[model samples]
Target: MILKDIRNIYHSELDALFGKEEVDSFFNVLIEHYLNLKRIHLVLDPQYMITKEEEQPLFEALTHLKSQKPIQYILGETEFYGLPFKVNEHTLIPRPETEELVDWIINCHTERSQIVSKEPQTKILDIGTGTGCIAISLAKHLLNTKVSALDVSEEALVIAQQNAELNVVNVEFIHDDILNSRQTELVSVFHKYDVIVSNPPYVRNLEKAEIQPNVLDNEPHLALFVDDENPLQFYKAICEFAQINLKANGMLYFEINEYLGAEMIALLEGYGFKNIELKKDLYGKDRMVKGVK
Candidate 1:
């Protein structure tokens, strides 16, 4: 079938299942994923056609989309901070907000370098580095920074390791449950990092009903949530780790639950961290919180 015919059918199929707007969005994403064709390309070509063999994957992908699977998962890869990274059900898809957090770190590193008073080699650790997006991006952008990434899930770490190699960045990846107090392996493997960053599981269980099916059904729940009563559990653990492992005046950055900005700032302050700052995202919601240990 011609590309136009396929898109029309795909849109109609999806629109009946999802909605007209969501179907349109899915169609655009599918075209890009399957044909390496963007919306503009569809407008430009107008008569582009998909071969029979290509049609199989396209139709299969459309089936999953109708089931509400995320396009990134359907494609098996995504761009994070301008770097391509492989993704799957084991890892959460990297978001644009996290990219902003990465940019902030890179800019901070550059500013420190300009003053000629920065550490010779800044060390960084990305806790809960699901796909190693944060760790790998930092290693790629900050040339002299040594990076280590840790995840509890061996499955997630495998994907994270692959992403590191794919991005041509050097990252020391470790597999360990961050929640286990006995897992001193990571605690001792690398002690003093200049910066520790995380985009850990901040979603609460009670909020599950609010999550889109594309995420709640397909993405790793281990990488997505904590008990509703202790929504800040990961943040608290990570802060405590930073206290013991981070160098004096070292920075701690987190992509926090938007609803808990003030509470997170308070938590960091209680940890004796200084220069606590809360920053909002493009949506004007409190999204990032940082503190200097």
Candidate 2:
């Protein structure tokens, strides 16, 4: 079928499900993934024909899209921090706000390096590392940093390991539950890190209504949510761990639920973390928080 026809069908079927703008984005991404054609190629060659073999997968993808499956899951991969990451139902698809967290970390380290007049070989840890996006991105961008990532799910650790390798970054992947009492023992094997970061399960169960069906139905809830009664459970655990595991003057970073910025600041302060900063994402939501021990 011709590209224009495929585009029309995509819009007709998906516009209702995802809206016209998102459908256009889906079409562009799908065409690029399947045909290795850029968006310009579609516009320049409106009559570009897709082979029967290619059409089969495109049709399958459209069906999945119509069912409210995320396009990243349909594609089985996504780009984050300019690196390719393999994702599955076992892993949470990395989001753009998380990329802002990565950028913030990088910029902070870059500024520190300039002040020190040398790039210190900093050790960094990412707790609840799902898909290893944060760990790998920091490893890739901060060349002087050694990175380690931890996840409770073995399946998530497997995907995270694959993404680390895919990005050609050396991120240590650990498969231990952070909330377990055994965490201290597991963490002791490694030296204290200069930085510890987590984008852990912060979505309260009460916030489910705000989540889209594609995420609620298809994404892994293990990485997305906490009990409504204890929304900051993961944050508490990580901060406690950081007290012993992070070096003196070490930094802690978290991508948090926008509603809990005040609570997060209070929690960090209660933990004796200093120089706390709450940063807004591109959308101006209080999405990231940092503190120094």
Candidate 3:
């Protein structure tokens, strides 16, 4: 069958749900993933043909897309910070705003890579490291850094470990709930670190309406939400942990809820973290915050 007809079917079915531009992007990604053909190949060969067997995956993906499943999960892989990662239902898909947070960390530490310091090794930890995107991206870009990531879900950790291996970056994966303070072994893992970063569950239940169906329906809720009554529960725990675990002048970063930026600032200040910075993403939303210990 001519692939063009399949492309038309995609437009007719998905245009109302995802719009023309997004449908085009999805079709392009699907064709590349299933048919091993690029959009350029399609443009150059409008008559390109695929056997029935070659077309099955594309149709299956279309069915999933109709249900608002994320394309990245359907593909089982995504690119973050110019590196590839494996993603699934157990792991939240890495976001562009999180990429901004990773970029901030890399830029802040890029000088450390140049310094020939015989002092203690630079260590960094990522809490709630779904897909291990932040930890692995840092390990790939920053030199001479020991990176560790922790998550409550063993299934998410499995995917995170696979992503670490996929990206060829070394990351220590910990399977423990950050919110559980009673675990003795969990405390032992919090050695002094040069940096502690997190993009924890910051979304309040009230904000669910703001979330698109694609995410609210498909992504892991454990990684995406917190009780509206205690929206800052993860942040509070990480803050207290950083106060004890960070080295002198160590840095702490978080991707935060935009609506709670002022509250975040107050929370960090109350925890005695200094040099707090609330930065906006490309969308100009207060998306990330940083503090110094």
Candidate 4:
């Protein structure tokens, strides 16, 4: 069958669900991934043909996409901070807002110092790391620094570990829960960090209606939501952990819910974190917060 026919079928089936442009994007990406054929290839050879076996994965992915599954999960991978990461139901797909958070950290760290440490190198920790995107990206950018990531789910940790290896960045992956008192104690004893960052479960149950079906139905809720009445539960826990584990003059960061900027500032203040800064993302939503211990 002509590959153009497949492309047309994609638009016929998915254009309404994802829009024409996104369907084209998906079809192009799928053909490239499964067939090693770029969009230009289709333009150059409109009658491109493939074996029936070559059609299997594309059709399977189309079936999942029709059900509103995220393309990242359907592809079993995504790009975060310009690095490749494997993702699954166990891990949350890294978002553009989170990439902004990473850029802020990278810029801040890069600008803060140029003199490599004569003593202990800077240590950074990412709590609730799903795919190790934050920690690994930091390690990849920051030189002579030690990076570590912690997550409760072992399944997520497995993917994260693979990503650490895939990125060729050494990230100490810890299997522990930040919200659990015993595990937090053990984790704190392992190392005090110069920087601690987290993009924890901040979305509240009330916000579920705002989420798309692709995310609500397919993504990991354990990495996404909090109770509406106590939406800051994870933030509060991580803050408490940082209080005990963050070194003096150390920095802390969070990718936050857009609506809770004021509350986040107050939370950081109450935890005695100084010089707190709330930052907006590309769309100008208050989506990141940073503070000094």
TM-score of each: 0.93, 0.95, 0.96, 0.98
- State in Å the error of residue 145, model 2: 1.4
Which of the two candidates, 3 or 4, achieves a greater lDDT against the reference?
4
Candidate number of the best lDDT: 4
Would you list the rank order by lDDT, best first?
4, 2, 3, 1
| lDDT computed for candidate 4 | 0.92
Worst 10 residues of 3 by lDDT: 181-190
Instruction: Report the lDDT tens digits of candidate 3 across residue range 1-293.
Output: 89999999999999999899999999998888887788999889999899999889989999999999999999999999899999999999999999999999998877655564654568999999999999999999887789998899999999999888888889988888777776524544657889999999988999999999999999999889989899999999888888878888999999999999999999999999999999999999999999999
Of 1 and 3, the candidate ranking higher by TM-score: 3
Clashing pairs in 3: none
Model 4 stretches astray by more than 4 angstroms: 115-119
- Give the whole-model CA lDDT for all candidates, comma-separated: 0.87, 0.91, 0.90, 0.92
Model 2, 1-293: lDDT tens digits are 89889889999988988799999899889888888889999778888898899898889999999899999999999999889999999999999999999999999998898888765689999999999999999999986888988888999999999888888889988888888857655775657899999999999998999999999999999999999999999899889899988999999999999999999999999999999999999999999999999
Expressed as tens digits, the lDDT of each residue in 74-174 for candidate 4 is: 88999998999999999999999999999999898887765444546889999999999999999999877899899999999999999999999899988
Cα distance off (Å), candidate 2, residue 231:
0.8
Against the correct fold, how does model 2 do in TM-score?
A: 0.95
Quality of model 1 by C-alpha lDDT: 0.87
Q: Is candidate 2 or candidate 4 better by lDDT?
A: 4
Cα lDDT tens digits for candidate 1, 1-293:
78888878887788777888877787787777777888887788888877898789889988888788888998899999889999999999999999989998899878988887645888898999999999999999996788998988898899999998898889998877667757834565546989999999998888888899888889999888888888988888888788888999899999988889999988998999999989999999899988998
